[model samples]
Target chain A: MIDEWYPVGLFSQLDPAGRQTALMGEPITVGRDAEGNTRVTGGNGRTLPVRLRYGHVWSSLGEPKKELFAIPEADQPGRRFVDVGVVRVRCSPLRAVENFLDVAHFPFVHTDILGAEPHTEVQNYKVEIREDVDEVWATQVKFYQPQAAKSASGGITTEYMYRVPAPTCSVLYKTCPPRPSEWDVITLFVQPLAEDLCDVWPWMALFDDTTSLTDLIHFQQTIFLQDRSILENQIPCLLPLDPGMEIPTRADLTSVAYRRWLKRHNYTYGAQLVAQ
Target chain B: MHSDTTGSWTPVALSADLPAGTVMPVQIPAGSLALWRTDSGHTAASADRCPHRGMRLSHGFVRGEALSCIYHGWSYAQAGNCLRIPAHPGLVPPETIRVVTHMVEEADGVIWVALGRPEGRPPGLEGLVPLRSLTALANIDAIAAAAGGKTSPQGIVEVASGTGTICLLLSRQDEDRTLIHVLLKGITDQAARIAAVRSTESLRRKAEDIHKKEFAQ
Candidate 1:
């Protein structure tokens, strides 16, 4: 977990006075150097590796074997890259990613907007851990949403593909309402301040051309704020790796697969190893 | 007051404070509880977690007679049994999918939660009526000092006021905090009630100030 890259703040919104943040419980300061490059320094006066990508500043405590994951849609033409700001929640970072991977909660947690009553069924989806890239992917996931996006006019059965390229980060590819042929890329990059605390940075690459930037940001923030209550109040405050700890239904395929992958990689940070 | 071996009850909240169809979080020696009342005025205290997903049931809403989780709308009955799962409407939740519930007794306009297998009933406050409950940043000792009285074996502190005698029902909320339910004795008029409220507020300020001084020392 220490060797992984985590987003601390959006590059465009970094404080010139140096924003104080933490990574894996270690306090760090994010500021810009004289050359206008992003600089991340640890509490012990050690300079950490900084990578400015996906409109956010990334940092790592240990040396990362691989570079940051790629989102090709970010560089595509006519795509609006939105930095949805950060929301600090008192929950395990892994739990935040697992909640993002869940589609069944749309009907309840995000009622009327993401989903509504009578359409709570989560269809069968395919979940696999790609050995080459060492990431968990769930494809062909479909859910009935009332307002799937800012530009959505009415209810639509949204098709989604979720990917967990990093331990604390998840990228969602959902059917774009305006351009059904293309997918709207939404990502949740979590910064683990402690085992039971996280700062979620939600970014989006969308094809919508009508909605204003403030409206688009508010739409995303409203959806995530609705999820914040659930994330904070979950009992145990840690992601349980033990299957017996939490019961899962057929709709929880992505969560089940994600937990298995985390256990396989020995990613126990912010994870409860045994049932309490 | 009963012996510890026979178990004891904790005054969680005033019955008037927890209205029908609402849920609130309360604490006891065992842990936290989701104190809720059904729409029909039936009250129950359950473990503050949804059995399915561990979401705090206190954050959930009460629908008709069941407490529905805000996360997935999994409703649980006041008896702690799973009543419905909105995600899978057709499936009746298994008997194993039930939250743990504690015994609750509402007496003298106060809600008491049993910690274990408590005996007898909560102590009766025969003539006094609860005015309001407030949480103080000070402990029981500081509160008693502020009121110029000592706590009785039943956790009641009596303060002689200009209008009437003020009765404080004390419950230790945490190490440094106390939950105070202020009751009035021989006071019924609106003017007396207002004076009691003002006096209680002044007592709380003094108690908190004393607590801060002790901590500083």
Candidate 2:
């Protein structure tokens, strides 16, 4: 988990003095060098690799074998890149990613904004662990969402595809209300400050031209903040990898696959291995 | 601090503070627990975690005689047994899917939670009436010093006010925090009650100051 690149701060929102943050429980400072290039320094005064992608400053505590995962929509023209900022949640980073992958919570947590009563049934979805990229992906997921996006005028049955490129990162591709041909991309890049704490950086690449930038950020922030209360209040704080610890229904296929993938890779930083 | 297996009863809250059909989070030496009252006024304490998911049951709502989780709507009875699963309506949850429940008793306007099987009921404050409950960011020692009295074995600290003696039931929430339940000894009027409340507030402030100073030293 320490070897994976984690987002520290938004490139546009970094403080001049230095932005103080943590990665995998190690205190780090995110600042720019004299050349205006992003620099990350660990608590031990060791310089770490820094990558500026997805409008955020990414860093790693250890040597990473692979480069930061790519999001093709971020590079697409005419797509508005929305930086939704960071929300510090007192929960396991794995749990945050799992919650982001879950569609069943939309009706209960996000309420009318994402889903409403009687439309709570989560239809069967396909989940797979792609060996080619060593990533967990869920496709053909459908849910009834009210005001699917900031530009949505009414309710729509949203089509969603979720991808977990990294243990703590998840990118979501959902149906774009205005441009049905193209998908709206929303990504949750979680910085695991500790085993049970994280700083969630939610970024979006959308084809919406109607909503203002502030309105777009607010809309995303409102949705994420509604999830914060649920995330923080979850008991045990750590994500339980043991199947017996948490009972999952058919709607939790993505979560189950994610946990199994994490277990397969032996990534148990913020995960409870056995039932307590 | 009390052990979970001991026959010790910890004062969690005042009876008047926890109304029927409401749930609240309470902390004991062992850990945090969800204390909820059924619509029929039956109080129960269970491990805050839901068996299905780790969602805190305290965030759930009380419908009829069951406590329902806000996340997935899995309901639990007062005995901590899984009553229903909203997602799987027809299926009856297995008995193994149950939250750990603790023994609770309400007596003398105070709600007491037993860490284990208690040999006796909670101590009775015969003539005193509960005024209110407050949390002080100070240990029991600091509170005792501020009140100019020490706590009895029953966890009662008697401090004389203008009207009569006010008894404070102190429960150590953690190393630096204490829960104080104020009780009035005599038949006090509204003004005296207000004065007692003010005095308790002042005592808490003093205790917190002392605690801060002690930590600095």
Candidate 3:
């Protein structure tokens, strides 16, 4: 388990006048604010004062080490740089679309599973092998209670391949957050075209209606493009995955567990960082 | 500001919006409250004021089914009784130091906080489950006016979305703002749910913008 990559830094501020800064570090751009606060410039040159929450620009992308039955699910831990103020979230081995149940790692820490009650063993599990590249699709099936979910129609799945050297450029999964149940999931994946950049190319295969793939792509990219400035300026960018070195803390349980599982299975990637 | 004006349960939050173990600031006619959940994930609404320094209780964090104040680490039970005081770890806080409590109902997957003792439980809307809630620039009147309907005696507004009926629970966010809790009529496709949410957002923008425009003029 050897990860040659390193955490660039946490994205801090994306200020107008071409000044950006990375955290635990220096300014990536010029001076942050002409006055001392972030100013976001809109089309036609209109600027709005941007006030971000503490560590928001740094800790927006969720790192998942969830408890399935109150059992730590991450055999090996994961670390991600997060930025939520802008529209797009950039993660390494990128988790394109995180669903609701990705708990642990706070922002994504402590999520509840569906079809499977808390502490109940996963039953009726179906794994469908995909043909495109090489991947497995996992569907967590369950009947909905009137109190938890209003209806059940098409089944749901959280399908993705956690191949290292950066996870599958995107995640194909259905997501809803931790609740008592009673919600539908968005099944989609992220298509990463670059290490520092990617597109939210959404999937149109799961639904019944005729939503234009072009439209979904446009919508997702439009939002993320607006978020570029803020996300790129992170500090300790993405944490380097060092398989040889073991850094264990109580908080690292979930991430460490996930990483360990990935290593056990022999996940691999190419020596190239492609530019899309 | 008691809702003797309309005896009803008000929309506090949509199911998806309020994540577990976090306290979100919510509004009622009387004032705001620290609406949060314990670590085990149970919804509780207590007076927004921390008993110690009267700081906003919503500024606190959830430990394990109890909300702890951000300032002095004063913990309170779901029923609004003082549970623990960091200053006096072993001593049980007197009952009098408790913040006022509100009756909470989780009917139809939406968490509803009763402003006062309502006559009956929250209305069981046949099929709809809570989605998410967002603050709007418009108040109840403008929302109803924009939705082409009026608020029911219970303060719920029904809207027709993409041929499906969606119910909105409207509560005052502040002086000129309203917090909307949206739920669909019944189960439809997840895409339909998204459409309903989008439609409602469009309606809210129209209504709130209109209200703002009118006020500006």
Candidate 4:
């Protein structure tokens, strides 16, 4: 496992004692070091180190440059360091955001409000980040016409970025898009709970408006909760247990890529991964 | 300053602010309140302290018709009576064991909690709808001073903006702060509502700055 740093939120901005519960029912607390590095405490006392980061991420491509370094192997030799934390993932690089484009499931999964074809698909295009793993996501939109002026109705186009070992992700959604031609993306890093379970958190490039941020979050949360009920109830929750049933269709390409990516990276399980 | 002001009721929040099935912490000249609205849309304000084990009731979550404490999960009804003690499911809680409740009333979108046995019902702003409630870092006096007005006989400092005049219902949260309920005139434009939100935030910042500066002196 590489100690590749995936930028989440700023260490200084987040309170050490502040605790917020995720839609996954996992409560995470964030603390900052004197040097302004973030240490997120999850479930038990499990803490993950975080560094503030932002580089030329083409909202279109979502990749930062890679650099190499070395370190010493403990008890084996002298200073044998390794290439440290550098993220090169596409925007919204997790299932939580990728599955969001599954417009058909909205009606059956979340029956209350969001339904099938809530809005028309504005665009369906893909961009590849220059990494070992390829990534993609579709963007759809529902603009409030002059008639429904009260709501901040715009479009949401999310992209999914995939990075290896770090298994880090980026979830980017821009309003009134054609996403940002330059930059401005709400980046997120998805941490795996189990093989199937994952927690998506915000990155340095945060959602711009507070109210819009809350609304988008709650909407996504409602959808995530909708997915949780079905995913948790599924018999073979994890993929490795039943790879025998690797049936595929044209639309299942993304899911296939995700499964392949998980396999290529040493599949993480239980408390062992956190110690790294 | 004597803790309780006579016949004055601070607006803990507007009726629409709490929403159905939610509980929030609010404060007044008297003390803090665990303000909540039930599933049925009725509002209630009780002492922030839970009767069982003195947990902060505001930290409790609202479910159905009852609000349950975060600690021991002691549930209480809108009337402040202990309804269910989860650990003692078989035993019904006695009527004697109950939280100290306060008189709460909602009139014309504003929800008012009495300091003692206050005057008449909360003043009827007949045509105003509640926009939202926010905590401001200023005392009622400081808010009034910032607004260049006095706390109205009805306990509010009116900040008339280009966006249909926002009435600041100031409740002294503690020593140096007040909870301001930003309200808009009913039938105002959606644009006006947006402006109201912006206007109130600016007003709060000014009032808070005044309060803090004066305190330093």
Best by TM-score: 1
| Residue B165 C-alpha lDDT in model 4 | 66
Chain B TM-scores across candidates:
0.95, 0.95, 0.84, 0.86
The 10-residue segment of model 3 chain A with minimum total lDDT is: A67-76
- Candidate 1 clashes between residue pairs 3 or more apart in a chain or in different chains: none
Q: What is candidate 2's lDDT per residue for A1-276, written digit by digit as tens?
A: 778899999999776678988888889999987777778999999999999999999999999999999998899999999999999999999999999998877877888888876677778889999999999999999988888889998899999999999999999999998898999999999999999999999999999999999999999999999999999988678999987888887788999999999999999999999888
Best by DockQ: 1
Give lDDT tens digits, candidate 4, residues A1-276: 223333333333466564343212345555555775455555666664433433211110122233311111112222111111222221223344334433323333554344322332222333323254333433332321221111224323323322222344544443322224422334434544334555445432322333353455455455456554443332223333124332222333444454455445553331122211
lDDT of 2 at B199: 90
TM-score of 1: 0.95
Please state the CAPRI-style docking class of candidate 4.
Answer: incorrect
Clashes of each: 0, 0, 47, 17
Instruction: Report every candidate's CA lDDT.
Output: 0.90, 0.89, 0.48, 0.51
- On the 0 to 100 scale, the lDDT of residue A247 in model 2 is 80
Give candidate 2's error at residue A79 in angstroms: 2.1
Decide which is better by lDDT, 1 or 4: 1
Q: On a 0 to 1 TM-score scale, where does candidate 3 land against the true structure? A: 0.42
Q: For residues B1-217, could you state the per-residue lDDT of candidate 2 as single tens digits?
A: 2233458888999989889999998989888899999999999999999876689988988988899888877789999899876554567888888999999989888899998786777787899999999999999989998999988878889998775899989999988999999999984899889889889989999999998888434
Over the stretch B42-156, how does candidate 1's per-residue lDDT look in tens digits?
A: 9999999887778888888998999988888888998899998776767888888888999999988999998887877888888989999999999888999899999999899
What is candidate 3's CAPRI-style docking category based on DockQ?
A: incorrect
| Per-residue accuracy of model 3 over A135-203 as CA lDDT, tens digit each | 333445332221221122333332222221223322323233232231222222232333434333222
Q: What's the lDDT for residue A212 in model 4?
A: 52
Kindly indicate the candidate among 2 and 3 with the higher lDDT: 2
